[model samples]
Target: MSAAQRLHQYLRDARRRRSVDLALTLLPWLAPVALLIARWQGATPAWIALLVGLCLIGAIAWRHGSRLDTPWLIRRLNALRTDMDDSADLLFAREEGLRGLQRLQQAWLRQRIETAPTTELRPAWSRRRALVSLLLAALALAAVALWPAAPTSAALDRLSPSPQIAAAPGQPRLVQQALRIDSPAYTALPPRNEPSLEGRVAEGARLRWTLRFQPQPDAVALVFHDGQRLALSRAGEDWSAQRVMTKSLLYRIEATAAPQAQTRRLYRIDVTPDRAPQLRVLEPDRGLSLMTPGQKAWPLAFEASDDYGLAGNARLRITLAQGSGENITFREQFVSVRGSGGARLKRYQHRLDLAALGFAVGDDLIVQLAVDDNRAPKPQSALSPSLILRWPADLGSEATGIEGMVKTTLPAYFRSQRQIIIDAEALIAQRRKLDGEHFLKRSDEIGVDQRLLRLRYGQFLGEEAEGEPKLPTSDSEQTPDDAHPAEAGASAKTEAHDDHDDHGHAPDAKPAVFGEEGSVLEQYGHTHDHAEAATLLDPQTRKLLKSALDEMWQSELHLRQGHPQQALPYAYKALAFIKQVQQASRIYLARVGPELPPIDETRRLSGEREGLARRGDELRAATASDPTLTALWRELEPGAGGTASASIDYAALERWLREHDERVPDPLAFAAALAALRDQPECASCRAQLRGLLWPLLNRPAASVRPRDGGDASDRRYFDALQQARP
Candidate 1:
């Protein structure tokens, strides 16, 4: 390439880079702005803004930005490119009349340029500046893309002015409205202004409106769609009205002046109702918890929110399972939780004690949070998802051999108690060989062990230790079951066998099923073979063992009373209850959690909001105003009565039908054919065929054509003469 061509090409590339930089900067700003517009639901504004931005970018990119003239190129080449040795000046001189010094210099410059490489003539690129601009632009674009989004519709409308009002044109006659809505103090809402005619406002808001009509009408009234009208009291040229906005509605302005040019324009109002409280669990991160042996407490945390605010207090709904396996009963209690945070958001937390809930080693507790909001008509509530806190069977421990299998597979918790019963039996058996004082002391120790074991069993039925008749208390309030702790089948400890033998009954005759569907005996009933019993003990054998444990308990009690004879029978009974509870079966109780009110998702943000009344107004305006045309149109509509009238102007009707509908034939052409047939009655067959074609046309109703208001005098005279000549 020549030096001038090289210089121009480099400058053109530089111009393109400038355009690219401009577009990059614009893109970062434009994309986010377009997103915001879309979020606001402004489709027209988004499209218009997008089109304008694209045009501006295009002009800069392909036209204005790329305008690199030869003169400007030469100037840039001389200033930036080092290889051009004053060749620009020599090149410029070639275009002008070269006098003495210029001609000599031009010749020298040409010879020097010829010796240099074409690469030397090319303008140097500012790579560092371009790279920096691209990086900064990319960062800005990413930042905009990653920004947190705002809420939709209502929130967007609140921040930005209505595009319709902003884009409305200045007209000779137009209705404008300015609304101020004062929310009730109880709602804790502030007053708001809307320049546009329509938007949502708080229910029970006091709405004040100022209506201005250009070319000023004399009187105006707000006509509601529900057949109610509120007359605006005039003050000078403006009209005003005030009313408490209790419900949403569509309304229009009906204006009247001295000359009576009736004018109408419509608007809409929406009322936003207060929303219910929402509650969700925020901590522990899981719904179900299988607690370890040593876990003392559970961490409880929740989040609650309401559109208005929260009042009173939040509560933890606690459901405790009060037995082992299938016979478990669920008991629920509401415990108040300390809530922190104002109106919008609140946090609730409590450290729940496992022991206080009367949970045994095999029992479970189900819990959830409940929240209430201050809304009325009726206050609303929300319940969090249920969470389980269980003292599960020791499935986590590793053990070996048949003993290990028994420890892992059986109800392992009560195995120690059975050992205590055996020890007591052995001690009672050797009582005759020891001294009286020593025997009494050891028997007393065994009695104490027996009471402790009974209390441990009692806790599974939500009971306290022996001698402590009341249930335990924790941070939360507890409501005990109606049945006393002593009555829970473990009551055999309180009454001796002597009383049972004489009365034929113990206190509280009802048997404790121990979380089984029936008696532990019933679960293992029947089956006599040792091999069968080894596989699994039958219910009858289990019943016999339970009877033996009851006897062992009485025997231990008698020994403690310094009478070994009475203790032997009870010691046998103590052996029975232990053997039954240890059988290996899958022990499962249906976990019951907090009972929550069913959520009505359909009621969310439910309120009255209508589309803009202007769209309906446009549709009404486009409807035909002339009654004749309207009636004709309706008659021609699908499913309309198809009756035809003889008086109808078939020619005019056909013309109207042909103009409005492509399906109808030309009435004027049919008229000319029939008229020609009338004159040529000599051809009878042709005339008959024309009459058959025109018979349906003759039956249609004649068009009631209104005379033209203004017409040419000659045309009017000719039409008058034709009317006069008609018979």
Candidate 2:
């Protein structure tokens, strides 16, 4: 390449270097500026600014380089590149006389440019300046990143249009006002004061306003948005008003003087409603619990929390499902929960005995803690999720199919009792080594296990009692209690049918013949009625088992109260009772019946359908006998608007009902009225008819029948009478 081409390249290279150095110098400044812009206008604007800054820096550097043409390059070369003594300019001259000189000078210039060190020729960067700028920028970035988030209120206020406050000229102006907020004692919060009129307070807090006008007004009153004005009593030169804040409200202070009326800024009272007490089951940690073999009582540990305080309105609800399959019966009850601590926080614990809850061996117990707060008007309650405790069916027997090789005669839970004893002994041995709290916790845990085992055995007895069938016999004939686990095992093994079952009888046994196995009373008996044959424990045995469970409960309570030493004696006694009861022979008596006759070779097993129609007529005739229920039932039907067989004086009934709307004498009558009203509320005439019908119920006394026996004989009679009396 020629000298000019080389020099041009050199100058171009120098320009690029200068641009880079200038960019480096401006880069540090650019970053912070971009970041600052980003803070206000977002990343897009910051990026735009950075791009503009880099372009400007590049343009300036390019302009400087563009100025350095061949002549300027010669000058810069002499000044910074080589020691040409300013003669390097001659190398680019194109004058006619200087052509030869130019050629000779070109050679010298080419040599000088070629040999010139690139470092000196290239643009120099302000290293210290750039370094210092970078350091400052890094510090700035760190500060920005580490800066705390600004208050939202301050930011919003800055952006919002300020409202101009108009002050009355030469009037008694309001100067200072303070709102003293005193929360309710239940909240247990100290009184607080806010300089501004607007403030938030807990519900039921008392807010006292102290206002001082420039010149004390003759009268001052607090005006609420609801138009209720409360006059402030005078205290020295200031005016004050105290009002309990039951709900959120907006109010302003109005001061009246001789010439003008002054009003303070409008303020809003923010009232926070007290939340309902919250219940959290801490121990079980889950909504479902499975009692391993031998567990008797549930050790419930829970927390009750409220913003204010618990109103001591907390209870443990227990629901027990009795029986099995489709015949299951449900019973519910509420028991008091212990440990009602203060409003902020309270830990409660209660050990519930399955026996006490009326839970049977295979029954499921659903328990939940319900808590209410001390809110006025209407208190709020919160119920924890239900915790289910189920005593699963014995694993030994099968309801159907072939039996397994190993027949577990004793229920699985029986072994659980032995495990409990082992656990209790282990806990006792470790009690001395453990700290008081740990020791007590361990002891209580073992006590809970003991209670559970005791209840397990107790349920065996309870089930027998519930399952025992009542037989007609003399008082001298002892009524055996079916409350034996061994008997339960037998029933389980036999897969015994329900009391209502026909026991392989023909399907024609619609009205099942109830009788003991083969007594002469079989024709008039319903002994096969499983209801009659239900199992029960002997009364004496039942009482003993109940006492044993009670002792176990005492042991648990004592252990939970942190007295392991005191609980041991009761625990031992309960165990001893359990053993005694286990040792007792609970012989279940099987009823004997005559052997069946040989079946006829030519007969089929088909049932006789002959007498069904007559039997149904008899059943209907029996049902028609109850006149009151039949009349009530007829009146409740929508189609029976005026089909009453008996005369009812509508005018007199309407007048009576109007005079005595609350005095419905019959429970069924009240139900009928409600049903009629619900059936056709919009029909005025129908409503009047229902009201007329209600008068009879209001005038008539409640009807009740004492069942001759515990069976459905009384119900059958009542239904038959009702059917016969139907219009």
Candidate 3:
């Protein structure tokens, strides 16, 4: 320590040693009898003054008074104390004398010091270092004591103190004042947020949403339907929701009708799962597209995502079908994102090579996408919307419809194709399950390729359920579900006298084993494996009818290729022979109807077989009770003439009319009559109506076209008169 500093400290301690403050007094050993020192600064002066005063005599004789020595002084103080104690015992007989001596000694020391020049001694800071120290101390004291004095006007009450004492020692008075204070209570929480939807979805009959989860176990997702109180358990961490069929794969989720606005399936999973497997595409909607010549292979992409705080393990099967019927598939390719992986719609691009698919102009491109997650929780499965791309460069002017797709309904096409695939699959499964008792029948759901279904009505069926005809019998007997596939063909044969004919696989039928040279059984198998009967057909008869079919197909193809006149004889021959095949098949004819035809007529042809089998049905109904028509039928003489049918055809009269009339009337109206003479002419009233009015009408005139635009175009009568004048 600095010398002056040490002196200052000593002086301060010496002063503290004499202070009467209770807190100060509690520290007894701190009292200085000017005997010695502890942690003192500037205390020598006080010690010097006290010594001089107590000297009582000049440093007597060269100050050889060793009494000034600290140790010597201590000894004298002790001796004086002993004498005083003895005197008090002998005279006053009070111990108070010695006790009072110590107290008085300290008091007297304080008084002397004050009289000299007392200094404030802080318990912390040493006092009286110099003028600077004193000023600092004063300023500190002022700031504390006078700090914005909380206005004492409305003052604190003074306590009367202990009755035994004049004042309370340690406390300061109180007062009332308002001070600015902080509020540590009310608080507002922020609103919740989520990621937004990023893109568009294709229009299709069904939309499906698959939830993907992470594997290593994080949390679990709890999904609720629109307003179901409890969520239905789905596959794994995965769940599926289907729309009628869903409109688009992409649907933005807004506020859900849940207690909290935050709605999501919560799943507990980790970033990675050790044994996660690729999601099974077999879960649903898995099949290859039916490729047409020059058709493209499908190109696909998928979105697989996971909950926050976990990794989304997506396995996308991206495939491309180019023009040459070649297919490129990217399967089980892993796509991963960590922690609340995002679900923003991102276009994962793929291009199918035109040459690869063997596709030419006017050919369709079929693209497919299969997606799934390979995480621990139930993996998610998704089939992206199939895209039909038009290779405009190749299609040229021929590009139209779904291929060129100028105004094609893509969603419809996809739905239809998928449905056909689904149905075909269902038939195979059903056939694999059941035996020969079931087969195909005509129904509303048949597709456009009627002839493609078969030469007659179907693939085939092993069993026939045509029970013996009864003489109008009893009360109530519903027709049994026809067991024979040819029930359809049988009706057509009898009708075509016009055509019927058509199910699916018979599980016990052993697939009608065949070599691939030219699969008659396979073709039949497909027919049975379609919706023609919805699952009831035999395979053998389907094979036998194949040759006849080739002929018919070639004829139809030529006809379609603007060679209808060349196809005329073939169409007629096929019709008659196909009918014979159907009739001989033992009602075995059956078929899986096409998915849907491009035209209504195509649908009906495939479904009912030939031109309206229902026509003869209408004819029968027309003559059943009408006397005039019935009489005509009876008198006309039927081909296989008999009273059983109670009908006939006036073959001679029809011939005479055809020879005499230079021109026949609307030929279709006289169809039955002409066929009866040239084919099967009958004399029912409707037939007479045709011969009587239609043929003569045809000789009258040709229908006329209307005037162009607005000029000379307003006269309906003029057009009609012109039409009448054509003949």
CA RMSD of all predictions: 29.7, 28.7, 41.4
**Cα lDDT computed for each candidate against the true fold:** 0.59, 0.63, 0.35
Model 1 misplaced regions, further than 4 Å: 1-177, 212-220, 226-228, 231-240, 243-248, 256-263, 324-330, 376-378, 393-727
Off by over 4 Å in 3: 1-286, 290-298, 305-313, 317-341, 344-349, 352-581, 587-727
TM-score of each: 0.31, 0.31, 0.15
Runs in model 2 deviating more than 4 A are 1-170, 233-236, 257-264, 311-313, 325-327, 340-343, 355-358, 374-379, 394-727
By lDDT, who's the top model here? 2
lDDT of 3 by residue, 566-611 (tens): 5445545555555666677576547888787466664654655665
Worst 10-residue lDDT window, candidate 3? 180-189
- lDDT agreement of model 1 with the native: 0.59
Error of 3 at 421 (Å): 34
